[model samples]
Each structure stands twice: as C-alpha cells, then as structure tokens.
Target: MEGIEQNPVMYDLMSEMAFQHSPVDVKAWIDLYSRRRYGRFVQPMQDAWNILYHTIYNCTDGAYDKNRDVIVSFPDVDPNSISTLQTVLNDVHEQYGKRYLRRAILEEPNDSYDKPHLWYSTSEVIHALKLFLESGNQLSDSSTYRYDLIDLTRQALAKYANELFLDAIEAYKLDDLHAVAHLSEKFLGLVEDLDMLLGCHDGFLLGPWIESAKELAQDEDQERQFEWNARTQITMWFDNTELEASLLRDYGNKYWSGLLRDYYGPRAAIYFKYLTESLEEGKGFDLKAWRREWIKLTNSWQSSRNVFPVKSTGNALNVSQWLFEKYLQDLGSHDH
Candidate 1:
C-alpha cells in the first residue's frame, strides 16, 4: 500500500534516473531499473522493487560486494535496510517457488525457463511464506513468532486478481468460437449449481426426476400441471430418442475430468457402467457406432495434444502452449 512518494529524495532520484541511465549514482540505477522493468504497468512498482532489491542486495549473490558501496552513497535511503530488502525478496521467492509446485497439475511440457517469470496471487505467495515460516524456512528462526500466512497471501492475492482477470478477459476476447462455447458451458454449470449451493427448491428441478404418481394422477392444480407438462415433454423426448441418458453419461465424464477430479474416479466408473449398459441393448448407439465416432473424436483430440508441456514445475514460465499438442497425442493414444 505504501508508495515510493513516501520518501521524497529517494522517489525523486529514482523517478529522474528511471528516464535516463547514468551509473554515477545508485539513484540512477534504481530509477532506470524500476522504470524500465515495471513502470509500464499501473501498480506493479512494488513488485518491481522487490525484484530489483533481490537482484542488487542479495547477500549470497555477490551483489552486496559490487553494489553495496554505491548503494550506501544514496542520501535519505537506509543502506542498513538491506535486510528489509532481503525480507521482501525472501517473501517473493519462497511464495513463487511454492506456487510453482501447487499449480503443478496445470503445468506440463517443460518449466525450466519459466520459474522466474511467474505472476503470483498475493494470497498464494503469502501462503508459501506461511508455509515457510511454519517450517522455519531457516532452522534458526524463533518458534513463538507465529502468524497466519493465508491472510497475508489473501491480501496480496486480492490485489493481484484485477491483473489476472484482465489478462483472462483479453485472452478470451481473442479465443475462437469453440473456446467461447466451452466457457459458456462452464458458466451454465456454475449457474446451475447455485440452486443447490443456495438450497433453493428449484435446484431439484435442474436434474431429471419422476413426478409423484398420486400427484400426477390427481393434480389439476396449475403449478402441479405446469410441472407435469414440463416433465411430460422431457419424458417424451427421452423415450423418442433415448439420447438424453447417453448424452448425460458422456457429459458427466467430461465434467468429472474438468471440474471434479477428486470425486471422478468413482463417478467415472459409474458413468462407464451406464455407457456399457447403453451399448448392450441392440440400440442404434452400440459399440460399433461408438468405435466409429471414437476414432474421429480421438483423432481430433490427439491433434490438440501439443498445446501443453510434458514437463513443468508449475511456474508460468515453464508452462507451455506445446502441452496442447501433447494432449492431442495422448488422446490419440488413449483412443487406440
């Protein structure tokens, strides 16, 4: 929350030197470095500063040996606060490092070049710091100095969301119709879940269910009549084509993989059973039809496998578009 303006001399020198490069003073270096690296972004100065600080003041990196004398020459800035600089760098480093791992499932193909270039939510970074503190990232730390890292990470993450959201929106804007359709379906899934999460009676209406027989036989009530009417239409549709169950089974598997991997193993097995059942009947939707369609679909899926990376440490830098290609390859193999 603190801005560079809090310190007039340091701020002025850094601001001026940022526009021009003269190694005469540390003031010039900080100015140019900050502006060149981060000033283009609206509010990323703090992040830039932490990165610069780490690069310059890192005790273990020999920065202290080369730049320490020049850095101390700056007026109104505490050379002694090198420790504070270290703290900020430590915080960023530890947090980003952990994010590299936690997001591993999303990373594939390769991550070697991507570790240092990641953008982290304030909360995620803070969570990493929390984990570090709890583990005494250094064995020398005091045990009683306890604090919640999640809260800290949350604060940072919240601020970072605007940037992330903007990026996602821009990406979506450039996406093709297939991506838009997928996004729409995902939105619909979330909206449908609201009824259940909010405990609304209408939630039950989202899924398939048979009406009570007595109510069906006796109801002349308008509300009941409307419900029965909707149900009848759906039932007729199902009986006429026998497509709903098959579609549900297929969609359920896709949704399980995308959004509910934790509960998917069992659910996928159940869905597989239903799929097998659907094929057992001498219906049009038999194994022969499945095999024919599967060949084409898996081919398409395989073609997309190169979009992601096969190796990663979950860092954004490591994440690659080539992983999509790999996915397509895997789909082809799986289909076979």
Candidate 2:
C-alpha cells in the first residue's frame, strides 16, 4: 500500500483511462464499505476496496458499472456481520503481487473476452468474488470450490499474452520486420503453452488429419471439402456448442506477430505480387480468385495449432524460463 501510494503515476493513468466521461461515485462506495462491520479490518479494508474498485472501474471503462450501483445500494450491517471481501482482496493482492492492479489494468482484452472495451466481464469478476467468499477467503482451502492452480495459470498466461500483443502492435506500427518476426514467434509459443495447459493439444494437432484429407481428395474442391469437414469435427470435439467454439476461436487467434508476419504477410505479399504482375501484363488482378485463395490459406492455417514441445515441470517459474529460452531459440532460427 505504501509503495502504491508513493507511485501516483499508475493511479493517474488509470483515472485518465477510466474517467473519460463517467466519474466514479467514490463517496458512495466508501460509505458502503464503511457500513460493513469487520472490526479492526473495516477501515483498512474499506481503503483497499476503494482503491481496487475505483481502479478497476476507471481502467476498464466502466465494465464493472453494476458493481458501483450494487455497492451504493448495500445495506449497513452489524460489526459482527460475516463477510470476507476484505480478506479476498488481500489474498488476491498478495498472490498477484503489489502491481497486480496495474498489471490487470494494462492486460485488457483478457483471454475470457477478446473484444475491445470488454477485457473482463462483470459476471467473471462476480464469480471470482463469490468463490473467494464461499471458500472463507482462504487461499489454501481447496476442499470446496476454488481457482488456485488453473485460474491463476490462466491469468498469468493472459497477462503475458497481452503484453506480447501490445509489443507486437507497436512493432507493426513501426514496421520493424525483425522485431515483428521475433515477437510473433514468442507470442505463438506462448499460445502453445496455453493450449498444452488447457489440454487442447490433441484437437489442434491437425497434421495427420490434414494429410489424410489431402490423400483422400482427387480435386482441390474435394480437398477443401475434406478439410472443412475435419475442421468441423475438431471444433465439435473441443467445444460443446457453437458459442463455445466462437469464443475459443476469437480468444485463441489473437493478432500477434507470428500470425501477422508469417500467415498474413506471405498471403498479402503474394496478392500484391500478382497484382503487380497482372498490371505489367496489362491484365487486371482477379480479386475474386485472390479472395478465394486467401480464404483457403487462412482456413488451413486456422486448422492447425502452433505445436511445440513445452514441458510442464510443475514449477511455474521454471516453465516460464523454459518457454522464454524456447522463444529465443525460435527467434534466432527465424522459424516462424
């Protein structure tokens, strides 16, 4: 808390991002926490809660809008009322480190939601709070409902992915080709990490199926039909519903360096090359044909996962280091 207070830049940036038009009802939220009875923990908890809620609200552009009203409408309770909000916040802060608030703010468009201005949904936040409360705010209590390992891993991966994505965007803007290729490989490697952790390795390993599809088809159209069928089957195997598949696709296929430089880069280069060639020959570029070819290329790329041998040694730090080394090696080889 002292460290955070000393560094006002983060809070300032959060305020600028969050309070563009909608000013937070700070007094109302403070009043809500003040009314709660948590003995010695009351005031400190209120202060922490205010900082967290205000930061979240501001940084996320009011995505947690309902929480604001909910807090304002909360009824006063006796000093002995059973509540673990304070405990949960403390645990989250400790586990995630002092800069968790800032990291969370910067890591928008979280893995759960890929759309702009929808990094984290209200329900997801509420669900996390509810789990903490239900578990008596004990991080060690895994007997009941909990999100210790998997959720934390997911959050860590999401944060890393978002950081890489931001770097990639900046590199792309600058048209730094080497940085683009290096960062893209690292991003894809991270995605591979996530896929392995989530047990999505089997479904996305499309090399065998693609080879079979190729062998079974006599014509290009038949090959495409086979590929589509295989893709549909793979989708169904991984996801229970169309909505689930869509979410997976949207969140999984983030616009990272590897994807942009390797997949789109080649296609775009080929397209423009053909355009130039056609112009030189006094024939117009066949937009329809190019579009068809692009679709086929994209589909083929989408069908396969970025497969890499990433060992899970049960140590998070060790695993992260391994991934980093792999990323560096991949970049050195320029093996997009």
My TM-score estimates for the predictions, one after another, are 0.17, 0.32
lDDT by residue (tens digit), candidate 1, 1-336: 112112233465556766775554553355454334322322233343443334323335322112111101111111111111001112222432333222222333432211111233333333333332333232212211111121222223223322222222233334333443443343333323321221211211222222332234554565454444433332122221312222211211111111121222222223223233443442322434433343333233322212211121121111111221222223322110
Where model 1 places Cα greater than 4 Å from the true spot, the runs are 1-133, 136-147, 175-336
Tens-place lDDT per residue, model 2, 142-207, is: 311122223323333444444454454455445455675666566655655644433312222235
Q: Candidate 2, residue 247: CA error in Å? A: 13
lDDT of each: 0.27, 0.38
- Candidate 2 regions off by >4 Å? 1-148, 200-294, 297-336
Error of 2 at 221 (Å): 18
Query: What TM value does model 1 have?
Result: 0.17
Distance from true position, residue 224, model 2, in Å?
14
RMSD of each: 24.0, 19.0
